[model samples]
Target: MKKRRIDIVPLTDQALALLEAIKPYSGHREYVFPADRNPRTHCNSLTTNMALTRMGLEGRLVSHGMRSMASTTLNEHG
Candidate 1:
């Protein structure tokens, strides 16, 4: 399959601020979602589950559910 080039728009002020704050929390790494062993690598499923638990959404919202919520909210606004 051929890869298509995608353009990324500039981040909003809120998004940039969130990135700045979360960078320190993630040991100054570029990726905020850190792996279990290395807080600099991409987090795996276990890490995601742990994050959900820490956020008090383990029982209430699964990953897919969260995506669905985002999709629904965006659709509703549009």
Candidate 2:
């Protein structure tokens, strides 16, 4: 996990729909989740964690945990 890698995540219909919904707001940007102060850069890595914390899931889940869960679910189903 230490090594940097590119992952090709398959988009589910729901995910695609969400992306479409956000297109008007972010589609023009280079990064969908661009930095607030600087659109040229990607958002802070802790953004997701911060959001989860705001939603009262700080101890229950972390951003990377979500990715791991998704990967597990996909592999198990496939």
Candidate 3:
């Protein structure tokens, strides 16, 4: 699974630039992948939650920590 996939409809130059920046593919898919395969293959809710608990024990981040960071960052330029 991939966290992100290419969308060709909104064919802006910026989107094309981002794809080139991350990765390049040599071929095309005959069938579109289902939505469930979006995230990294090995990352699931249980694994992420366990890691978050450990992070919290180490006085690091809690489950909702990233939400605020993303909201703040988006609000700045949103």
The lDDT leader among the candidates is: 2
Instruction: State the lDDT of candidate 1 residue by residue for 1-78, as single tens digits.
Output: 235767667998998999888886788776777775876587775665677889998788777777789999989999
Q: Model 2 off-target regions past 4 Å?
A: 1-21
Question: Between 1 and 2, whose TM-score is larger?
Answer: 2
Stretches of model 3 off by over 4 angstroms after superposition: 1-20, 23-42, 49-59
For candidate 3, give the lDDT: 0.53
Candidate 3 clash figure, as a count: 0
Residue-level lDDT of model 2, residues 24-61, one tens digit each, is 77756877898777878888879999999999998999
Per-residue error (Å), model 1, residue 77: 3.8
RMSD of each: 3.6, 3.9, 8.4
Instruction: Return the candidate ranking by lDDT, descending.
Output: 2, 1, 3
All candidates' TM-scores?
0.63, 0.68, 0.32
Error at 47, model 2, angstroms = 0.6
lDDT of each: 0.77, 0.86, 0.53
**lDDT: worst 10-residue window of model 1:** 1-10
Cα error, candidate 2, residue 74 (Å): 0.9
Collision pairs in model 3: none
Clashes of each: 0, 0, 0
